[model samples]
Target: MDTAILPLGTVIRRQADSDEQAIRLWLHGKSAHSQRAYTSDIERLRSFVVRPLPQITLDDLQGFADSLADLAPASQKRTLAAAKSLITFSFKIGYSTFNVGAALTVRKPKNTLAERILSHEDITRIIEREDNPRNHAILRALYETGCRVSELCGLKWRDVQPRDGGLAQVTIFGKGGKTRHVLVSQRLHEELCRLRGSSGTDAPVFPSKSGRALDQPAVFRVIQGAAKGAGIEQRVSPHWFRHAAASHALDNGAPISLVKEQLGHSSLEVTSVYVHARPTDGLFKFLNR
Candidate 1:
């Protein structure tokens, strides 16, 4: 018997000799959104665990997890999960003799999707209030397509095309390098065409004044401004449109499975959360006086 633990040849082409190199390799293939999020999460972990990667013990991770008590449950989970992933990657690359984070487990956070969902009326008010052609189109695209802010920001005119009956379709390069095609409403299709004008197909569908793609932060500001202008008291983000899209779709009889594909959800279970959040038929309704 070869008693030694062989390197994971399939996972990586070579061993990561240092923690820094291992960290780079771990984030190498992730989407930009994930890379940014995981970087912040890892940075939070680093502040607590000062020791080198291989030298860190379970106690260190436990203390790090403990430090996250002040953060919201979702934030805590994201931070701890990032640390566990990093340590596990280091171990897999043979940089660490043991996976220090393997024993540490972060509990799943409570679902808050219901709280974030915007009513269709609220969504309409926001869109109807935005007078700028570009911003108006942005709001509609986000709502009608149910795309993530990152996906919307990264969208190019080339990714959109005419389908049958004046409807347009979008090829979204979503998370984990997955590709999903979502149908665009005919109204939105015409709006996008009007916005495109003379711009090249390679140009971003939503471009800044500098002719660059509208980044996520800019899109966020657009959502916030629109929501505020619409007299919405609650804070709004680009994701509100996504939630509204899912919820409103299910409310209007769109199939859950279809919503799953449009949103590029990993599983039917993920798509089902929208249904669960706003269940159409409930026993409580039957008990109404």
Candidate 2:
């Protein structure tokens, strides 16, 4: 494989790079959660098929999809989707001769991923009950910025820039490698700043207890522990904070457009869930009064 110069003198291996190398390089640019999920899915496919790309046919793909019948429908759908994506990616950058993934379709099941909505009081209790500074900062950043687990984990000290008025610009790399900035409130900024002060600008904003970058599982565990301590009965997931952020923001009268942009949602349709997701005090007060 040979190297090619990207814009600004960045170097990357050319299209002729090995299939495994090419896949790994592409995965590196994805958000951490996606990277982990896709890697595991693709590895499963490799183990199941164990054949050369060009020799693999649509029937082979069908058998793989059929094999996942015992799994949840959503898991089956996502695994098939990831397999398709791998084939598509392989063909796109010369890893394969054609995009066979186009034909490997699995019927998506109705989404049963339960959405856990956290109330403002629940959030307060969770925060107060969190014992450590690092986890406290994680919870706060997750709620305040409405960032995904991947985006929050991807943050670096250099990505945060302090402005004149005690606010901070937090740079986030969202899905599809899209970049966006969110301004942190003074209270949130202080929490981040305290951590930032201890680490180099290039280091992770929230490193793991092992002194390396924090993984998604670590963040999830922290949230779960905090929730248990706060006496929340519902199983709390990391994405719940993001949902709560959008819901609470809308409930408190923030514009949908602004919340949409803040959450890095591609369309209003995705962001619109928060509109009706929150509980309202009175729906017909104006109608009656």
Candidate 3:
């Protein structure tokens, strides 16, 4: 009989019957949104462990759970859940007989109040305060398109289509690498066209000083600058625009499904958060009578 030694990567693959590779492959197969979340969870767990895989003991798992106390209970629980999934998958594939994550317990965190959304007035003030044409377009595009800051930054000129007889739409690649078409108002479309003429089609729709796509921090600064100039004192971020758009759309009688599609939500459960934020009509006054 002849025995052959496997390559290092192949050795790792055969040791656990490719369990780690299976987990990695499975992670990649998930939506981009899920991949990001699971990767973060795995990173946090790796930080908690003192040794590499197969060397990690039950004590390490317990220590990781204990360390999670510093994080909100909800967050801790979610991270643990992610770790558990990975461990379970590893076990199923014969990587290890122990299910460390399965034995771990997570503490529940207190539920905090929901964050406040920007009012129509606040949005108006922010827009009015933006004096620069580019800044104005950025702000308007966020509110009009209901896109995340990342999606906005990734936008290119080719994504926008302006036609004389049809509604203008912008193609957005949202979380999870999901693509959706967002309608742009005629006014916003024209403004975008003007902005595009000045900044070339190949260039990012929202570019930094270096002409690269604007990063998260830059997007935050742009929103902060606009908010400060508008004289609105509320703590604002790019997500506020998404919240505001969802709220406004529901308030204006857009269907829940339409809102979900616009927001790029995969589930109605996620979109329900916006629906819950809808302002109530004066029913209390009538009900009291």
Best by TM-score: 1
Q: Which candidate, 1 or 3, would have the higher TM-score against the true structure?
A: 1
Better of 1 and 3 by lDDT: 1
Q: Which pairs clash inside model 3?
A: 73-109
The Cα RMSD in angstroms, rounded to one decimal, for candidate 3 relative to the true structure is: 5.8
Question: What ranking of all candidate models by TM-score puts the best one first?
Answer: 1, 2, 3
Every model's TM-score = 0.93, 0.77, 0.77
Local accuracy of candidate 1 as per-residue lDDT tens digits, 1-289: 1121435633333467666788899999899889999999988877778877878899999999989899999999988888999998887776777787989978999998899999989999999999999999999999999999999988998999999999999999988899999999899999999999899989999999999999999999999999999999888999989999999999999998999999999999989889889877879878968
lDDT of 2 by residue, 27-77 (tens): 766765678788888887778887865456788898888888898887888
- For each candidate, the alpha-carbon lDDT, in order, equals 0.89, 0.81, 0.77
Q: Ten-residue segment with the worst summed lDDT in candidate 2?
A: 4-13
At residue 40, give the lDDT of candidate 2. Answer: 87
The runs of at least 3 residues in candidate 2 whose Cα sits more than 4 Å from the true structure, single-residue gaps closed, are: 1-28, 31-33, 93-98, 194-200, 209-212, 276-289
Candidate 2 pairs with clashing backbones: none
Stretches of candidate 1 off by over 4 Å are 1-14, 283-289
Model 3: how far residue 219 lies from native, Å? 0.5
RMSD of 1: 2.9
